[model samples]
Target chain A: MNSVYEGAIQDLIDELGQLPGVGPKSAQRIAFHIMEAETEDVERLRAALAAVKTRVKHCETCGNLAEGEQCSICLDPRRDQSTICVIEQAPDVQAIERTHAYRGLYHVLGGAIDPIRGIGPEQLRIRQLLARLQNSEVKEIVIATDPNIEGEATATYLARMLETMNIPTSRLALGLPVGGDLEYADEITLSRAFEGRRIM
Target chain B: MNSVYEGAIQDLIDELGQLPGVGPKSAQRIAFHIMEAETEDVERLRAALAAVKTRVKHCETCGNLAEGEQCSICLDPRRDQSTICVIEQAPDVQAIERTHAYRGLYHVLGGAIDPIRGIGPEQLRIRQLLARLQNSEVKEIVIATDPNIEGEATATYLARMLETMNIPTSRLALGLPVGGDLEYADEITLSRAFEGRRIM
Candidate 1:
């Protein structure tokens, strides 16, 4: 946290350090960058920072980030509202969209269940998801959460709860990635790939 | 410059990308961090960013960054004003201070003579430095610029100018570092060390 700068320069470093993924050294480096940047450029950055808070809002239906009542995905009429691909965060929605494969809607769970982090379904948008599925024509719920331990746990919990509602639940496949060398694969990944082997 | 967020989020990413050292993916990551950060934290960061430009100013005497007429080092009475250590940038001032070995004052050239970048002696604080040395009680001038080619060129240029004024000039040594392994030392560094070998 210690830096050579004082007053405003030091203050900038402190504030930048509070950001996620930014360490003390990175904060100092970035603060210097801001110090040397042109006035117009810095002003633009400040405006963008402030505008994000005022203009961006969470989607009322799927808990995804949006500029209005709904995100771009939720607002699109061409998307299949009957099938919702559930994900853990907004970034996951972006990743799926980049593939240009799925034409369905999305439901952001806000976060996965992490007992260590004290994050549970109660703290997430699970209630909103259940409420959305109540009176809807939704036939399938695609759980596209990350393939990590926490994601798997959340997927299982949601699948069990969704079983009583008679809605078909599907989890993303857990296996070897495309073009991955078998020799370099981890034990658990290799085992999962063996179990989930497809008939070609 | 691609981000998962649309509207305000994408705008935030674009703005953040303008900062030095931050790439497209880093901009997206930082934008997401700002999105998730608490309102108070983001507000504080904004204020700090704005405060830096408004509050910080270049020191009148040495061209170093200062909150007032002079930098803290220049204002201090304990420093040796008779000997001025000339350096390339403000960060060099911090680096020299960390050593606690030299008690002399500093003269920041702002930048070295980089012909490729069109930065020359005329673009630096060389005029101000000469003026300070003219009617003042400065005895020896230590050219403590970096050991790079540009730094050497700047030092030689300053040396030529100061030669007519009869002020003693010196430079930081170029050789093997204290804790560096001999096996990893480059040829140029080894040859320099050989030339500057100390008598046992």
Candidate 2:
């Protein structure tokens, strides 16, 4: 709103509103707070915005983000080199890590194949991933993309691509979430839960 | 969560999380977006943040945010000087303006008298507002603070202080919102609605 706000404050609000998930009202509130904030505090935030862009880069080998050429996981010696987790984005890497269940190197695809958005296999990091697998002794690849239509499509394509390569590939199982009520489960999820049922 | 993020990126997340409504998860997401944003876009945001801090300041007369010594409202000769609307904060001015109503001068209190948070009248612009009232032809004052405890307290205090000045005072009426459903109305609101019933 034009209101009586100065040009500088309005410009700040416009800039903040461009951030994902921050709408117009939130941007205005944030601009006012930043204006009233301590000089050192705003400076710290400014430095961070500048530093992240300058310091962070994609890990050349795996397509995940990194400060240098290789991500921390790729540089770590203890992670399993024989198995690699394939994820859609760098943030997905963080989500999987929080589970503390995986201890292998990761390959970030940057995004999944979605023809609706004009994104296809060639647009992703699939070529780089194939290159990583060619000379490596990796025996297994875990496709950890979301269970949506696009994610499944990507996983199926990758599985087919690796069939001749002889490296076994698997997808994350679809099931009812733990601690969730069966009544609240959607139809497709219920069917998937049945399909994935075990003898126990 | 730090996960595999570099130090600078993590610092950025922390700084962003300190903003009013942003949590750690949102902060992380925003930081990543900032890192991936175009250099020109990020520079514009940075400049806006810096300029707001350097150029925006409080209006000397009304305590509202201003680029110059006095706010636009104060400088506008068309505004009615006989009627002054007292509000809790500068943003309140915008809210009132958006209503397309009220064309009088405004006095910003900076904040209400919040004792638990250690804020008092002395912390506000009460003295300046009082000085503006002196030897002026102002006929009425509208105490448009919030309807919450602190706002009501401030309004009551201001009304009592202005009683000797013989100028009429008023508050924003509390009632059911225009499009709100009466079925889902809370008790306090329902009572307010009943109390504020108007004759046809």
Candidate 3:
């Protein structure tokens, strides 16, 4: 792939190709774009790359990404303290916040339980969540992990752990998404939709 | 888009979104990936970005990206300098080189004629190409601009300009792409394929 391009350009393309979604062609396109882009824009990207790692750290309480010891959600006095929404990662917290629905505090588990990937209950921040619950007067827990296999496994594990704590625990309902046709829905989703149906 | 994440994370996401083909969702995903990536990887990307701008410069002779005054292709003595393959940009030079078909030298015109973007013949390195031709014993010119409107226009403009030079000039053939289904070929492509048909 670096056969034709010269020294610096080839190096840049190789680095860009290492990104998650960027392929060889896209890496070449981006490297060319950067070559043609304003110096200021490139400098900004470099600065952002440098700042993301050096300035950001995990929240001490929730394990969410934070600038200091605690994340903004943990520091906010206006947010509900009686309930905690347990999720897989910081991006999940961002997604829930975008809906403007959940106002309660959040607990990031870092990742879900996937034995194939060597991730288990001990590998996650479940103990930290339990410790936080013990210290706080939380009355309810919402397990908002993804609807996938790993997420489901994590939710079940967390539910079993929280059952003896006497606090009410719930999982987010799974059903057909809005604006989706019932005829096109997959069997699993359709079954869930039917099982979770409410009398209107 | 930056509603939830803290300073450094939000800044990284914003910068990532500015890249070509990268949307806000992808930006967030990549930013988080970077956040979780090893320090060595992040440092490699930063070094690449910094070195690309500082070390790379346009080829003084052909307008292609080069580490020194001239591009590798321009400096190579084994390449066929008598036949110069004229292309729209440096990436086109790369695409042609990847085929391992042509051994001729290349002349990059920077970009095709784009009136909507206010680019004209003077904006490109056309004069440099003409000067090179006048000073050299070149025999042929291959117009390998893109098959799009701007590329055709640029080819036509160059052909008219090169007519007096008496050097044989040719354009790349237009037809259905290899491995592409004939049924899915567009009307314009089908018409061109017929117009440019060759005898076995």
Local distance difference test, each candidate: 0.87, 0.90, 0.91
Candidate 3 clashes: the total is: 0
Q: How far in Å is the alpha carbon of A75 misplaced in model 1? A: 1.3
Considering only N, C-alpha and C atoms within 3 Å, which residue pairs clash in candidate 3?
none
lDDT of 1 by residue, A1-200 (tens): 23667699889988887766677777777877788888888898999999888788889999788989988888899999899999998878878988888999999998999999999989889999999998899999999988888999899999999999999999888888889999999999999999999999
Better of 1 and 2 by lDDT: 2
Candidate 2: TM-score, chain B only: 0.95
Off by over 4 Å in 2: A1-4, B1-3
Output per-candidate TM-scores for chain A, rounded to 2 decimals: 0.96, 0.98, 0.97
Tens-place lDDT per residue, model 2, B1-200, is 65457677788888999998898888989988998899899989989989999999999988888899998888999998899999998889898988869999899998999999999989988899889999998999999999889999999989998987788998888888889999998899889889988999
- Candidate 3: tens digits of C-alpha lDDT, residues A1-200: 64579888898899898888988998898898888888899999999988988889999999999999999999999999999999998889988998898889999999999999999999999989989987698988999998999999999989988997878999999999999998899999999989999999
Residue B16, candidate 1: alpha-carbon lDDT? 75
List model 3 lDDT by residue over B110-175, tens digit each.
899999999999999899999899879889999999999999999999999999888889999999
DockQ of 3: 0.79
Show what share of the native A-B interface contacts model 1 retains: 0.68
What is the TM-score of candidate 3?
0.98
Off by over 4 Å in 1: B1-4
Model 2 / residue A114 / CA error / Å:
0.5
